[model samples]
Target: MNQLKLTVSILATAGLLFFIAACAQMGTLPSLPASHPEALAIGQQVNCAECHEDQQKGTLKPYKAFNHSPVFVKSHRFYAASDDRLCSTCHKSSFCNDCHTNKVQIKPSTKFGNRPDREMQHRGNFMTMHKIEGKLDPASCYRCHGRANNERCIQCHR
Candidate 1:
């Protein structure tokens, strides 16, 4: 009975810790900046720099910055895709082409190689292990090679 009680207590503690970590990761978002609402209300263009307090590294951080807010990461894709020139305001066309283009692709890995501590995609052994990974996550492959005539995919898949 005592052992079972200890086990249950340990599990309960672990569950609570997990819940706290998840809450931290799913950051609490404050209300949208006054500019967003005011811009929409008055039919004016929204300027992000107005609300963002600082620019660090490359990311434009909002006034109440918390490194990387989960809310922003989840919704940024929607904001980027809906506009034609919105991204150019903050990001170069080359930034979009890095992931979206079918041409001689420059891997994010190359850019991030200088910072070895940062989390990176397609690790050292990826080239050798990619076939199994591709089979498991075909959707990832399609992101870069969605074209029906993708020569890159054809080189291996065909």
Candidate 2:
């Protein structure tokens, strides 16, 4: 009977350690900044830079500053607008995208030694086409668009 009790206590201790490790991996719990009350009243109109003065340049400023806020982190789980739409609610998309696009360059490059011979190159565009013939799954779109109460199919299709 004593051996069974010892085994149960060991299992319980292991379970507690597992829970703490999982939470740590998920990330730190958000904290409410002292300025939260003043910032909250302004609604979405508050300029992030007004409080995050040091973040005049990179994506880290908005990400770290807002993630620390109780409001931003809580709402982030329900919607995918925290970075751009949240700020763009007051700022323009062009202002944000100009810096963002440059930061996230999407240029495709040919792999070295993998290029086709010049004489064998086709006259038209040489872009490689990948044909995925299968019944497309709609569930993938739900990762972002599925959560919002107002999201429409046209938002992505159009």
Candidate 3:
């Protein structure tokens, strides 16, 4: 009985040591300091609650604190314009190519599929109206199509 108890104690201690060793071998994850200096300098984080509502909230929240907001997609341009370096911290340069590919990508109508929502990009007979829209605001066209050489645009405009 005494030997059995001693064996159990040894096994428990060994198991605990192995667990600690394994945890140590797995390097810690990147963490935001209570106020990450760059984030504070950039004025993204004023307080802990900006990200961490609960103790584990910040740990689970994806990307940098402000990057996951619903408006981040629309608002990211302003932030990127101010400091692209901040954007680069999480978003790779390739991330831009997801939307802004240089090649002749599939049309959104085809890409979004042939569903009811997958009609023309604009409302009310866009194929007829797009000429007017393009002629009026070429800048808008240049967003997806490179200003220098857009074969798709040249095909129609020229």
Best-fitting candidate, measured by TM-score? 1
Clashes of each: 0, 0, 0
- How much lDDT does candidate 1 score? 0.56
Better of 1 and 3 by TM-score: 1
lDDT of 1 by residue, 95-152 (tens): 5565556654445667667755533457677667897898898887666545646665
* Model 1 weakest 10-residue run by lDDT: 34-43
lDDT of 2 at 106: 22
Better of 1 and 3 by lDDT: 3
lDDT, model 3, position 16: 100
lDDT of 3 at 117: 38
Query: Taking the tens digit of each residue's C-alpha lDDT, what string does model 3 give over 90-118?
Result: 45776565445577465544554544332
Q: Which segments of candidate 3 are over 4 A away from where they belong?
A: 1-71, 108-129
TM-scores, each model vs. reference: 0.45, 0.22, 0.41
| Deviation from truth (RMSD, Å), model 3 | 16.8
Looking at model 1, residue 24 earns an lDDT score of: 93
**Number of clashes found in candidate 3:** 0
- Tally clashes: model 2: 0
Ranking by lDDT: 3, 1, 2
Residues 46-134 of candidate 2: C-alpha lDDT, one tens digit per residue: 34556656554433344345542557534543434534544444446553332223232221222212333311111233223111211
